[model samples]
Target chain A: MTISWMDPHTTSKESRSCIDCHTDPKALGLGAGSLVKIKGSWRLVPATSKSRDRRLNIPRLDGFVDISGKPLVLTSRKDLRPFDAAELKRILDVGQCLICHKDFDDKVMKNWNSLSPPKPCKFFLKTR
Target chain B: MKKRTTYLLVALVTIGLDTDSTASYYLGAKIIMGGNNSVVECNLAKVEVAGSNPVSRSRQFIKTGSHCCPFFVQENFYMHPRRRLLTLAILFFSLAFHSLFPCTAVPPCQAAAVDSPSKVSTTASGQIDMCLSCHDERPDRAHGRKVLGCFSCHLGNPLTGSAKLAHKGMVLNPGELYIVSKTCGQEGCHTDQVKRVKKSLMATNRGIISTLRYYWNESKDHDADLTVEKLLKSDLDTPAIDYYRKLCGTCHLWLKKHTLPGFLAEKGGGCTTCHFYKPGVGKDGKKTNHPMITKHIPMKNCIRCHNRSGRIGIAYKGIYEAEGYGTPFEDGDVSEGQLSDGRYIKRLEPDIHFKKGLICIDCHNQKEIMGDGNEKAHFEEQLEITCTTCHDGRQRLEKIFEEDIKRPKYPLLTNLVKKNGNFFLKGKKDQKLHPLHRFLDTACRHPVHERLACQACHSKWVPQCYGCHVVSDKSKDQLDKLSNKQTPGRWEEFRSFMRYEVPSLGIKKDYKTRQDKVVIIVPG
Candidate 1:
């Protein structure tokens, strides 16, 4: 029997919400940070606290996987590993779209792929 | 001298025991001694004590409807006038005592006492069930009164005239798992099925308990040696076990049906949970027909318990349980879109299969619902049929073996038939022949969708509950479902950010197959 150790990701009340898996960098397997769009591409902005785990070679508290998709933590199961960079980018792109689209019933999302490449949203253009 | 005294003592006790007859005897004596007009009033109760030979005259009164007075009248001939008066006073006192406390007397028969003569019935197995004397309604065609008698399903004394003896070991509902062996599982009837059903995950609740324990970190793996049966025998309190007992215990087959309040009362019998035909009440609010045991299960039976947790039962029917604020108030009042359990819901597009009149049983075969006599670790492992099973790219029904039809795990044979050289599946609920449509060529051949499970795109929306907080308050005591005792450590769950939208995509890799497939994932 495993001892009563709280994996904050699962057991704690402050555990990640369902959306956090798509939006949060840590949940996407890129160590604790915020996803910021620089130029036209998504970039991972690492947290200011630079404390590192020398053993795993990533940030001590937040590192589950690096941006290249190599696992930093010992995964319990072989089948269930963190999202790779490509998979993370696809999910984050949708998360970014959801900021303005709000729901799937939006006309743009109904035939999203049929349309040409999306132009930068009003918020993204303002930030630029 | 001793023999005379013994006879006198017996006569006095007999008068006391038979109160109705003693009352008649007192009235007869009073009419004889007092010469009162009550003789005309109490003519029916008059027990004539002739001045002839007392022994023969008492026998005459018995033939003439004397309640009881033979012994007293026979003894009265030898006793003096004064002693007779004393016996009358004793009889009067006994009559008063019987009237004062009628409940203390031997109870009258309570079983349905038919005014007509007893009806005799012989079953197919050649046993006479006396229950046919009153209850003669034939059940289903299979379990007819002429075939499996009332005693076969309902065990009671079948050879007795007395109602109490006839109903001695009677079971009100024989489908209860506790005493099913003597009824549904008895020697020649449904024995193998009863055995398999008891071991099924629905009955044992093994998978649910083990999976919860694994998620709570109480177990190393999802496959744990925990079951509802074991918990019922002996309780082991951990966070997961406690939470499951308090919340998820009602939907198992081990529960006695109709014990819970409200619509839940119709749920969770061993066999009747799925088999029993639940009749509805008339407009006058009275039962129109008796509930019969049947193989043709209705969708409502599945929906009764499946309407919570996954909420798939209602989701298939286009009912989405909205958050409890009861939004979109009707006429300044709460919304009318509410479930029987009082959960607020909204209308949405139902599943295509449901809109086309397909039911849960049409997709989930008997093996998926009822186990194939194997103890599986999870529901997915036990589930045999998939979307590909029916909607194959090959454009034909899959090969169904003879053994599959015999054991009947693959029930598609019963419903699936070929007509005019075109394959069709008969809908289990609607009894309509639905054409077997193969997968579209474009979708089947698409390279990008190769790893995707059908539900990834086909499933429009899934109910997503976010930030579920389970708090275990040790100070309070909660009712443990397994033990049925108030145990310490109350567990409460709070959920917020409920949304029904396009599901998040996740990859589920089968380690054995080494195939990673994309599937819908919802928050726990």
Candidate 2:
């Protein structure tokens, strides 16, 4: 599934894109899927518009990612900059989604979906 | 009768009576007339005298007795003069006989005439010719007195006492003098010493064989036929061997012939004959400037160090026993009081100092003694004056540690400190740093270590470095260029520095090719 998010703050012609926070492991809620597991298994899920409406977890997921992965997404976060394929590959490779999600099995997916959301996301989801 | 008549006639002749007929007749007539007439005249005179006086007889007698028979008688006798003439003739004949037959008493002229033939010749040329007849054999008498000739010593003219000839202006006797002087007494020449040296360690057949073996070991071609032995024995013109023999022959002869105890000869008078400080290219392409002059130290003086009696412990085993100490003399064992002979003496602790099987040249070298100038003057100045020439003061004290301490291990790091800070470290603390770091710390201090590597400064101990780095292609090229570029007087320094210093350093710099490349992991 494809994921999208709105600019939290906008002032000039160049506004923040959804990929800025969601794609970067350094940003809040960016690495939430890496932390949660069911039946000792983990999976990465793309966020839908409905899921974005339900929760705004940022800080909790960021803590789950290793420090080395934090700077990867910051390289592509600026809006209106030229889209770099090599940079996109580097980000996807670090996220592990390109490899894990490409050949997703039903059983693995079912276990993945059953897991509880991380604290930052659950907090926002409960509040909503 | 005839015999009697002959005897009478001979008697008459002897008496000078005229035997010829005419003389007989005149004699007879004179005798007849004079006998009678003389007698009658004498009688008449007497009678006349007698008649004159009564005592005429007495008077006549008196007259006859007192006077000549008177003038008348004389006149009558004169008329009969034959008698006087006869008497005169008899006297003349007697005189003639005496004159005709001289007695033993004769004049000198008559005697000379009778004894010798009186014609004699006198000439200067004839006398000179007589002299030349005997003396002609010895012409150029002075020239003949040369040693080559018989007259070399036997000088002077045989004939003339006036003139003198000598073996003048000639210096040496040809046969005996030249041979003895050239072979025995000439200052630097020593053919007899050469003969003696042949029996020495350096010049013996065995020595040549060993040297050849050493050379063969160093060479790439290892074929037995091409070995040093074969090369020496094989009639090949090896300039290296020739050079070795020539240079080694000089001092080796002295060692063999002159010194007492004869240790050099026993060891090999040619100790340095084959074992010179030779410079050449090493396995690595570097120059090797071996200090050639250093190996030629007179072996007689080696006793100062190498003798059992020497103070420096220069003996084969002495140095090893003296290791780890400053000077052997510094310790109480080598006391000033005990050294009656004035040589430096010390108690040698074999266990602590001895490196059982070590050679002296392994540590000491001529370069250290002679310096880089390699001039005769410099060598003479430094030969036995300094301790560092034979001993590495730093290594002996264990100040720098490049190699394992063979004996008498001492703490060197404790002594070294940063001049800026007195902070010091010992053993492992100091050893833990990188090799380069330790090198910089020790070598970069105030003097900035003129010799960069441990081997460079301790060259006498580590002479192999010189062999490897002295004559490489690069250095040869540099030397060739330098030969052309350097000014005349200043060139020797450049040559020496290049030949000795550059090569020595090059060995350390080109450490990759060096055999001593074992990486030492300092214990942390």
Candidate 3:
């Protein structure tokens, strides 16, 4: 069965493939379940649980290999292929990349605008 | 020729007769002309003639002459008679003049008797023997034999009754008296008495002198210099030292010789010697016999007669004569027969009161415990021992509250009122009232609980209370028991009462506002 994405606050068009919106470069760093479609039903996951699930799916299999030299996996499933740089950028923009990892947020890392850097944690999570 | 010659001879004889008459008269006149010496000679010659026959001598001389010469010779002879008679009268007159007035030539008979050797020996023997009979009869009586005359020994007006011999017989000079009394009559008479007096506590009065000297040295030099002169001129004329010398010295010297226990001899009683009771009213309304009695009753060991609590029996309420008066009893117990109306009178116990043991020096001695085992000299050192020494009232109460009662948090209040007008209060109290008010209220409210007097709380700083209340080590326990009910709350109540009545009590600052500000701002 195919999943379609929809915005509940607005009457918007739906997509047949989940990758059309979920993998879109502009929607990558947006709300976690904002682009997901589940069997014609559209519901957003809880903010804290969505962020935690997104953290588990770190490697984009459609993109090049990460610094670990292992093949990048774009999907949460184990068997996904790597994608090229143009496709990766189209899938994850600079804004999206910056939001995905704490190190990429120049303003937060440099403490510019008096925003303190995120604190370290035993579990991999950002702390203001 | 014979008649003519006879006549001529008679004329010559007549002339001779006249010449003899003239010569006789001239000698008589010469005798008159002479001073008293010639008068004496004329009188002597007339005396000789008067002793011879006057008429016969005259006639014989006349007949022996010749005719005309006979008449002339007879006349010469007759004139001789008359001249002898005249000489005799003049001699008698001269003797009368000499008898009427005596010259310095001879002394009167009365005067002669005094100058006689027999009289001189008799007068000397009478006066000397009278003095010797009484004074020089014995060897000791003849103290200074070399100077034995009345005038020499006595040396006073003979008219006045105060001649030394008349008054005291023979007073040796001061220097001589000092030597003879000290040496000649040494151990035999008063030497031991003198020694005891010297060692007695009275003799140990050097402390007063030392105190006076210390004051003298510490005072301004000018003021100290005038002390002697002021003391001499003052009504108290005798200096402090002189009082000790006169009152204590002579008696101590006497005690040194006569009394046994030489150390205690000089300590013989003074003012309190005869006046045995303390100076006050006894139960009988009569003045107390001894004026120096103190509050150290238990220490005085007064329990022998009075109750163990030192309370006397009701029978002793009035002045009773000392024990053993009309009774034929011994040991202060009365005989039933001696009692009036067949009633048995209880006799006062013979306790060791002032007469037997208590002496002024025993209490008044300096307060410090001298390391040398001698009594301390300084007042500061001596007064350290107080009523609290023997009485454990406060300590016992505090202990009860702390250990038995289990009130460890109970407050302890120690208040000291100084003579200099300073009050020190240490404890917690409500902020609405002053510390003094709180103290007084606490003290007065529960008088039974805090039975202690104002003097008891204030005595540590103001020692003048001792003038009335005398406490010693032995009496401490009794005093504590008597004051056991005294508690801090009673003192607080007394303070509160004072504050309500007298609002200005204990507010000493110049301005009330200043005190308030200090109290509010200061942490303590």
lDDT, residue B217, model 1: 75
Estimate, for each residue in A29-114, the C-alpha lDDT of model 3 and write its tens digit: 22222333244222234232211367555222112232122332221111122333333333332223234333312343233221
Candidate 3: segments with Cα more than 4 A from true spot? A1-128, B1-203, B211-239, B248-375, B392-524
- Between prediction 1 and prediction 2, the one with superior TM-score is 1
Worst 10 residues of 3 chain B by lDDT: B496-505
Write candidate 2's Cα lDDT for B1-524 as tens digits: 12222333344467655444222212222232324464465443442222211122233433452354565332222334564455334433433343364344322111111111121111110011111222222212112111012221122211111122112222222112213233222333233433333333222233333333334343222112232223334444343333333222222222222222332233322323322233464333445442122323333334332332112233222222222122334544433232222333233222111232222332233333313232221112223222222124334333333322332232222223333322222222123211111222322231212322232222221101001111222122111110112211111110110010111111111122333210100000
- Cα lDDT tens digits for candidate 2, A4-112: 1111110111212223322443232233233232332333442311224345332221122222223211210111111133333333332333133322232332233
Q: Model 1 — TM-score against the truth?
A: 0.65
* Candidate whose lDDT is highest: 1
For residues B1-524, what per-residue lDDT tens digits would candidate 1 score against the true structure? Answer: 12222333345556543222222213223323233332233342333434322223334433332344333333321223454465545434433443353432233423323342233333422234556666756566566554555766787655444466467678878888888987888655677788888878888888678767776778887677777777877747677878998778888888888676666577788788888884565334555454578777788888888787667888888777787777664576665578877889878777777887888787777766878888776566676777666667334474643334565644644676667866677898898988767665444434434666666556666675544557888999977655556878888877645766535444567433668876555555
Candidate 1 achieves a global lDDT of 0.59
Higher-TM-score candidate of 1 and 3: 1
lDDT of each: 0.59, 0.26, 0.25
Q: Largest TM-score belongs to which candidate?
A: 1
TM-score of each: 0.65, 0.17, 0.16
